[model samples]
Target: MFSEDPGARIEEVFRRIQEERMAGLPFINPALSVAAVGFARHGADWRGVLLTPWGIQLLLLPAVADWPVPPLLTRAFRQYPAGTFAFLPNHEKELGDYLACPLISDMHPFADQQTALATARACLIALDIPPVRSEAQPAAPASDGRRRFLGLDG
Candidate 1:
């Protein structure tokens, strides 16, 4: 299992999902949700790279306004002028060091939650991340006498 290698596991997950997608299988929601959770969980390890409905946002924790821009961000800016959130890692006098700052200067609003999630998923694909199997759905509600206490017995 790729889980054994935390660093590479994320990529493996994205690759599998992308492969399945190319094969013409129906797209699944939970698969992308899992990817989002993974990104949320491990984003810091990847230099705070983040996905949003509008585009990618590089969150600079303990912000440095004058942070040196990386080539990846420069390209992202060109590709998504209103979408790239950028902050180059630098040490020339700390700026905006008190808070985490979004790098994108402009953004297009998502139509809704679903749209945002879908875009996030696409961003993962664009970035070459693989998806993993979905987690088990929550258990069904109990159907015993206790239902009356919860007002569901009506």
Candidate 2:
């Protein structure tokens, strides 16, 4: 169910989580979901992103993580572990739309094909992945005539 390609893995994870959310499953941490979006956009480098319930709750509120904990709190409550959060990266501009109005309440933010495809394209662009032209010719002729019959000659 997994792929060796980093981009493919990230995309798969994002789609699976989206499906679970749409089905009303009690899976996917909000922070993880957002982080997954970032990974799906940015690729393998951001795979380490994660979000604890406490961390997300604190971030949503007006209160700062240090307000109560100070030095006593060993962990950085607002800060995600390493690459767990996507907002920390420089690709904020590419993801600003999604980040600004995320599906904080909606279960299937990415269930819409248009939204998912656009987001994936944005991610690939952010990661400098070149777009493959659908009109590009195949290197060899197909042995089967189905493609020609279907008029998908390219």
The best candidate in terms of lDDT: 1
Clashing pairs in 1: 13-130, 13-131, 14-129, 14-130, 14-131, 15-130, 68-88, 85-103, 85-104, 86-103
Question: How would you encode candidate 1's per-residue C-alpha lDDT over 39-149 as one tens digit per residue?
Answer: 332222323334332233333332223433445323212112122222444321212121112322223454454655555444434333222225774332332212222
lDDT of each: 0.32, 0.28
Model 1 ranges with Cα > 4 A deviation: 1-37, 40-44, 47-55, 58-87, 90-106, 129-154
Top candidate when judged by TM-score against the true structure = 1
lDDT tens per residue, model 2, 1-154 = 1122233343354455456533444543333333232332122122222222111111111122222222321332222221121122111222211121111233244444345445434432332322223667543332222223223445
